[model samples]
Target: MATQPVTTRIVLASRPTGKPVAANFRLEQETVRDIGEGEVLLQILYLSLDPYMRGRMDDAKSYAKSVEIDGVMEGGTVARVVGSRNAAFKPGDIVLSHSGWQSYAISDGSALRKLDPDAAPITTALGILGMTGFTAYAGLRNIGKPKAGETLVVAAASGAVGSAVGQIARIFGARVVGIAGGAEKCDYASREFGFDAVIDHRSSDFASRLEAACPNGIDVYFENVGGHVWNAVFPLLNDFARVPVCGLIAHYNEEPSISEGHNQLPTVMRGILRRSLTIRGFIQREFVDQRPDFYREAAQWIAEGRLKYREDIVDGLENAPEAFMGLLEGKNFGKLIVRIAQ
Candidate 1:
């Protein structure tokens, strides 16, 4: 009889207080469990590192359950079916699964979405053609509702969701201004992503440049990095402007505080009331019904050269924790992916 394969996995060692570190994750090896009648054993190929995973590390309540101590670090992954007891999948089939930070995972074949390499690169199943792209599409369609000749601003313009938001808004005939951290990223957002204008948020005159870029008051704002960027954009929003709150990467590391001068709720509420603005926060899963529409349109746009995406891949599962930490600090150029297997 053949010996069962040994699987390498990373589990949550301790919850992070502010920023996650290597000590928060523990690596271990265990035998791959035998599949049941309806289960499939998956060999993870690519692991996606996203900002939302940071929120899950805390013990606080959120839209999703936290990653319990000693459990696998939660993430989305693309994998290959290595062994299957289910008829829906075969040994060589590639699939997208939420198998987290592990080399092997067992699934009941229910949550697996089979992937076809011929349609698009398998890694895209975890990136542009997947969650991030869907996030951009959903936010715009439901809340941002950008219209022709209107101006839209999105921060982190060279990133997965921001890049998509910019390009998609342009396709909808809206003037798009993007904000990125550095000169290189700003250049890419303008030249590669085709944003009408790109501002380097690190510039000393970032607010001035952003103001100049949007001569017409911003009609829609895709809020990604919500610290200083929000401060610059708030005053420039047109009356009845729509704001889709996507992420707050800048504030994720902040500890709970109500210190004087740190509270902006009063100021923000006053602005909202005066401007009659519409600000809505949402999770991608809430628009799961529109995923099919997103997949079809985004795929067509990619094939037609209207949409583009980039990825920054790090090799080895052991590097995932370090890569993820870098992601929160804006260290990655594009979508951060960990190549766990060939």
Candidate 2:
């Protein structure tokens, strides 16, 4: 066999205090390790960039461990098995693996799921048919529980999870109201994702506009970007409303000390007590047992035209840092994926 070339990877240069800068990541090349028994060499094709990644940048304790300094940044990737010492996989087989920000990886077949590229675009293993989509489904189904004719409001409405939330809510016969950062994204949500209405959070009249959109009041609030959106949506929630607290990308870059408006907790408690509302926070892994069912249902929905998805793919491993930074700023219009290899 010919000698394998070195693999290039982006490593964590330093932990960021807030918004991650490009200097916080470094590119390095290292010799590819020889595959051992039951090991497979994977060439990464697509890497997912998500809001949760911001939490992983910090050394602070979270549901998931943070990426240590000088380590390859952790991520989910769709890769092709280039070489395998195991009988379960072949060289050309595509698999979904936690390969991080590297061009290539060696894995022991644990936690690697073989995928069929012909079923859908292989890149989708990182997005719509994968974690992002599952997050939306599990969060909404378990927490939101939107009913027919009920109003479902979601922030970051054009993003991966939010978009799926809106579409799925619609499929379940709910009226979907989407809140996005700008007019363009708002248009995409309303026009493409079939949201009943779209509210531009950037607008001066946002709160009032959101209230106007949800005449029946928000029965389910899919909380993605917390902060002003949360403040606005709080008052508009109907009695017994469910809030699926999935992400807080808006506050991800902020320090813990930044003071905002006065205490609204008393009023929030009053609302919760009177209305019997439910609020739940979740990580997607909590629902992996539902993956088989989720994929079957979601894939059927997508095939039957009841679901739609969008992707924002940035080419090259070198561009991953910039793409990730843009993701935090809501600069990405869809599921953000970095194309690492052909």
Candidate 3:
């Protein structure tokens, strides 16, 4: 007799009205059904928690569909195949799939990518060597177009995406300036990541400090956190500057009442016109064709000691909701991943 398998998962209990709370998520468990043809049962090992997931939580329409109520919160995972009906996959095969916030899932082998633990850490498939790194590579290379001797500014310097963007820009011989929220993050961005300069965005003199840091003006501004960071960088954009609009995390949880007061779109337009700036917004998937190149180059950079990465792992599936809440509050450091199972 085949033994039944059970899986633990988290679902979106309710759409958050503001910053998400613990009540917004619910923990549940279900027995895994027998795998049918071309199906593989994945036992998730790691779950990635990204800032962008916050945008997906909203009920309003956006780039992706909202996670329906009672639906498993969507996310990427690194998992091991424990049961397989697919000819291409075997038991114990480590693979990458969109398993969301679950301890186990059934994948039909439609869009599964096999991962080799020998080449890089399996966790890299969830972060640096995966979506987070690719996001930095595709966005900066295609849009930012940074050049040697130019200055590049990135908000949230210690984060997964921002950190990658700055490090890659340095490889291009660009002066990298990172803006982080506190003294510790600023230190990490400078000492560990090799950023040319670090600015504490929480300081009262943040704008002037940023100006001093970029004496040549900013040739590329990676726009991850909008709002005040945008305001500070707007005037310092060198002529024909490129701004890659990535995650606008600063306004992610903005209350409409307070958010409605920002009438700076006109000012932003005026700056764009006067400076002839080249602003481009990009989603990581748009550069899917370049994934191979991304993998090769990024891996080489890591091997050559030009690239580095960090992870903040939280243990257990039940804690994903609390950790995710902390992610939005900027309580997490480095690439946030939940260790669901061994």
> Can you give the TM-score per candidate against the true fold?
0.98, 0.97, 0.98
The regions of model 3 sitting more than 4 angstroms off are 257-262
RMSD of each: 1.3, 1.3, 1.1
List candidate 1 segments past 4 Å from native.
255-262
Residue-wise lDDT of candidate 1 within 243-298, one digit each (tens)? 99999998777645523357788889998999999999998999999999999999
lDDT of 2 by residue, 7-52 (tens): 8899999989878998899999998978999999999989999989
Q: Over the full model, what C-alpha lDDT does candidate 2 score relative to the true structure?
A: 0.90
Candidate 2 ranges beyond 4 A from true positions: 255-261
- Model 3 global lDDT (CA atoms, 0 to 1): 0.92
Determine the C-alpha RMSD for candidate 2 after optimal superposition of all C-alphas.
Answer: 1.3
Rank candidates, TM-score, best first: 3, 1, 2
